[model samples]
Structure formats: structure tokens, C-alpha cells
Target: MEDRELLDQLFSGGDASASAWRAFLQKYSNLFLKIIWQFEKDRDEVMEKYVSVCSRLMGNDFAVLRKFPKELGLKSSDFPSWLVAVVRNISVDLHRHSQGRRRYPKALLRLDPIDRKIFDLYYWQGYSLEEIGHQLDLRKNGKGTDVNESFARILRMLTRYAPRERKATFPTSVPFNENMFVPDEEEPRVDVALFDKWLEGLPAEHRLVVRMRFWEDMSAVRIARILKIVPQHRVYAILQKSLQKLRTHVERNMASN
Candidate 1:
């Protein structure tokens, strides 16, 4: 069945919904297991996390499943990637729950300036590896650490941030490689009303990039295509420009106080 058709079947009530639920489980169960296993290598724990994920999906009559990006021009081809992202989130949460205690605010406060910047990029920028590589220049340092090793260490540092709400830092590209990335485990709520205030003052394109990329949690590439901005880099450019203004505004307020 087509992706949209499958969603319609699942979302609609009655016998069709039940059948679609089975089809969904049959289709994506393995994928869910794969993601869960990333957080835990033990088969028993993996199964436990997998069951937890399914329960969450089935909760409130499949509330999580209903959050499909259907309104974002979802295509059948895009379904698996979207599903993977969602599953990854659930798995990460399970992992964090096992890890015990949320200390993101404290952890963030303890980071050295350099490490803090790295966390910001990973957390807020949705930075692709290359962009982060450029910013941190992990390519080849005198230290004798390999690039992947260095980046992995940085990502390990990131596990501290605990995945509060991921403010939409729309990425410069595909963001991180999901196979290896460990995103925020959980995050405390942040009142971004101030940021939203600045957001309202942005130009149309800037506002769209910010709102779609960050607020809506849409991918940068997807936003580019949706906006029909050629070369895709234009989306990044506009986003960066918008962000600089917001940052400056925040800095100004802080300095005034």
C-alpha cells in the first residue's frame, strides 16, 4: 500500500485501522528493533526498549504514529527516514531513562568554552559532520587522534545535554549520521518567547527557514525542496543570516542588563 494510503487507513477508525496497525507493525517492527539496539547491545534490554517503543506508539490510540509529517508533503520514499528519526528519538529516550538522572543544565554549565560551543552546534545548529568538522577542525590535529575518534569524543560530551526540546537549528545539510549519533536524552523546558518575539520581526524567507527548520523540526533539505530554493545552500545562507540577528539581539539585551 502507498504511504499516504497506509496513513489514511491507520488514522481512520475500525477494521481498516486494525489491519493497518498490523501492517505497520509488520513493516516497521524490525526497523524499530534496529534503532533500539543502537542504545543497548543486550538482547533482553533491546527487546524491552523495543516493547516500550511499541507501547508508546500504541498509546492514546497511536498518538506518536499520528504525528507523521503528512502535512509536510510526506512521500512514500520519505517514510522510512522519518520513521527512523522517530524511532531513534524513542530509543534515545529509553537509553537516557536507563542512564539515570537528568543533569543537562548542570552538565552544560560545567563545559569549557570550546566544549560548550561544540554542544551548541550539535544541539542547536543541526550541524552536518562537515560543518562541525570545519567549526571544530577535527580533521587532523597534532594530537594524533583520528577524525572519527575525535568527533565521537565530542558527541560523547554531547550526551550531557540531555535532549530537552531540540530548538530548531536547521542543519547546513543532512545533519549527523544517525548510525553513530547520540542526540539529546532529555531537556528541561525553555521559555523561548523572547526568541519567538525576535522571530516575528524576521523577513519572510528568514522566518520560514527558522520556523520550518527549527520550530517544525523539518529537515533542511526537505525545507529547501519545499521552498523550491535552488542549490539548497541558499536555505542555509538565509538561516545563518536569521540566526545571527537573533543572537545579536540576545547579546544586546544581556549587555544592557
Candidate 2:
């Protein structure tokens, strides 16, 4: 069935089982698993999170689906993209929660004295880049550019030197229900491995912008606010350039093959 027909059936407010909810799950479950796998490399953890996402969407008579406004200028065709954004947010939240429970590695202590100070001020002290600039006397040329550059450098160093942790196993099983609908055939899947490889090859700033704009579904204004940058247009420019680079990379690879 078309997405529009399926959506109509869902929001028709008849019996809950009358809708295409089961079909919806079967169609999109793979996509959800793909998004979760990005943050969770372990197969077991990915499966666990995938089940959790289904539970969230299925609980309370599809409360999450009901939250979307019908008049929000979203068409039925936009549903998949919108749902992907929702899954991405949930996956990111889960990743953060799990990370919080893990022990802080001693590798953090190995940071250079100055980089450590900057890291602490920004992350631990909750200071914004502009504030950190003032505290560190890095407000060169009155734009806080120096502080931003320093913070980026520190981030790169920390990411490079962070100790890798082994994947943990978790026991999780999908619940059985009569209403569960399974797809007859698998949908064509994206080459996620190739895409991830290309994404990682981009410049750090470009990669960050791409993830924020696409995966996180963040507005340029919101991204600018988080990055302490002025004007949303800068974020848009970054996204455009980054996407162009990615497209070019893909084309070159395809030609070579």
C-alpha cells in the first residue's frame, strides 16, 4: 500500500489494529536497525535497541505516531524521512545514556595541560566557546575565532587518543504478538558501509555539519547555536559543500569500479 493510504488508515481513529501499523514496522524495521547500528557497533546491542525502538513506537496505541501533526506541511511521502529522524534521535539518546554508565578512561588524563583545561572548561564547567575564550584570553580579533580553533584542535586530539572499548553483549528478545506483520521480502538496502567510509573521509568540520544537518535533522539555526556561530547561512553553506564533496567522492569511486 502507498504510504498515504497507510497513514490514513493509522490516523483514521478506528480500532488500533485496523491500521497498517504492523506493515509499517515490517517495512521500516531494517532502516531503524541501520540507524541504531551506527551508534552501536555490537550486533547484540543493535538488536536490543531495535526492539526498544519498536516498543516505543508500538506502546500506548502508537502514541509516538500520533504526536506528528497532520497539518505540519508534511506529506505522506515525507513520513519515512521524518521517521528516520526520530529513530536517529532515539539511537543517539541511547548511546549517550550507555556512555554515561561507563567508566571514564584514564586516557583523558593524558591530554596536554592546555587542552585538558579547555576540555574541562567546555565540557565539565559547561562554559560556552565565547566564555572559554574570555577565561583563556583567547579572544583574538574580537571574534572568539582563536578559542574555537583551539577547542576544535583539542577535540581532535582527544578523539585520536581515546582508548577503544570492547563491545558488550546484552540479552534481548523480540516480543511476539498476533498483530506483528512480517515483510515478505527485504527492501533494497543502502550501502551503509560505503557511505560511512566516505563520511569519515570528509574534513572534521564538514563531517560534523553533515551529521548535524542530516542525521540529527537539526535546523541550521540550532546548529549555529550549538556551535556558537553567528548566522544560520554559514551552516547551510557548510552542508552544501559537504554534500557536494560526498557526491563527487561517490561518483569517482563508481567510475573506478
Candidate 3:
């Protein structure tokens, strides 16, 4: 069925609604499992989280599914990106908040629940301060939760555990993983065999350009100069095509699961 037709069927409040929900579940189950697998290797844990995700979408008269305001200029082709986004959020929150708490500094542990959640969202989940500020501003009686002040206070509390360097506290300028906020778990996000499988499929030129561009951090112009290509625009074109193909290959693998 078309995207609009499927959505209409879901909200039609008619007999087909039941079947529509089932169909939706069936269609997206692979995507759901694929996303959850990024955070867990244990089959049982993955299944448990997968079930939790479906329940969250279907619960409360399907409130979460209905929350998408497709009327706000959303196109049909956007469905996959939107679905991936919402499902990714559900998976992340499930693993972070609902499944189990990661080891945190005792100082952060002593903070109240909201404070801890804020810290986790910022420190571990890598939410921007502005995002957290806006989020807290939406909550009831959350007017006092100034993100800067709270983060400053949390830093003071956690200072003892931080390294001697000044950037031990997460700074806005640095990348998320470059700091101490990286998750303790070593997530096997990809199967090396499968990864090599995709890499092996790439054309030799595309593979060489990808390695130079990413691994060596070479600019398109530099890559062109190095490879003795006449015009640099061709390098840009090749890089774009290579990335598109790589993304397509990865998504194909995910959907197959």
C-alpha cells in the first residue's frame, strides 16, 4: 500500500485498523531488530528490547505513532528516515533508561533522578546543552533547571574523578567520543566479516578514495592532486557516489535482518 493509504488505514478507526497495525508491525520488524542489534549482542536482550519498542508504539491507543505530524510538510519518501529516527530514539532510551544504569561517578549517582537523567542525556547520550535546556523548559516546574548552572554544578561535583586536563569535563567544542563520556560497554556495532564483505564489493578507485578521504583526512582537491586527476570536481563526485553506495549497502544489510 501507499504511505498515505497505510496511514489513513491506521487512523480510520474502522475494522482495518487492527490489521493495519499488524501489517505495520510485520513490515518494520526487521528494521526494529536491525536497530536494536546495534546496542546489544545477546539475543534474549535484543528480543526483550524489541518487544518493548513495539509496545511503546502500540501502547496508549498508539499515541507514539500518532504523534508524528505528517501534515507539517512531511513527504512520503521521508517515511524511512522518520521511522529510523523515532525507532532509534526508542532503542537508545530503552537501553539507557529502562534496561540498566551504567556505572557513573558516585557524585552523579547522589544527584536526584532528574539531575541524573539530565547528566546521562548530556554526558553519555551526547545531547547538546541547548537541546537539554529546551527539553527541561517544557517540563512542569522545570523552570529552575538551568542547563548551564546544572552542568557547571555537576562538573564541580565530578571534578575529582575527571582527569587533570581542563577538557576532562565535556566541552561543547570537542566531539562526543573524544572525551570521558564514552559508554563503558564495547559495542560490537558491526560484524567484521560482513563489513569486509561490503568493503570488498566497492570498486578499487572508490575504495582508494574512501580510504584517503576518511582514514587520511585528505581534501577532495588534495586527493585529486595526489591521484593526478585533472579536475578536482571529479573527486567530489566520486566521493559522493561512493558514500551513497556505501549507505545503500549498509541499509540493505540492515533491512535484510
* Collision count of model 2: 0
Tens-place lDDT digits, model 1, residues 1-257: 87768878988989999999889889888989888877797999888888899888878977887878444777668888988998888888878765654223443433333444554564444464566656554443443223354445444332212223333232233234433233444453333655566678798888877676655545567778898988887776776666567556665655676
Spell out the clash pairs found in candidate 1.
Answer: 162-186, 163-184, 163-185, 163-186, 163-187, 164-186, 164-187, 168-214
Models 1 onward score TM values of 0.40, 0.39, 0.40
The TM-score obtained by model 2 is 0.39
* CA-only RMSD, every prediction: 12.1, 20.2, 22.0
Q: How many residue pairs collide in each prediction? A: 8, 0, 0
Q: Where does candidate 1 have its weakest 10-residue lDDT segment?
A: 158-167
The local distance difference test score of each candidate is 0.63, 0.61, 0.63
lDDT (tens digit, per residue) of candidate 2 on 86-161: 8888888788855543222233334434444565555444466787666665544554336676676644433322
List where candidate 3 sits over 4 angstroms from the true fold.
97-257
Worst 10 residues of 3 by lDDT: 159-168
What clash pairs does model 2 have? none
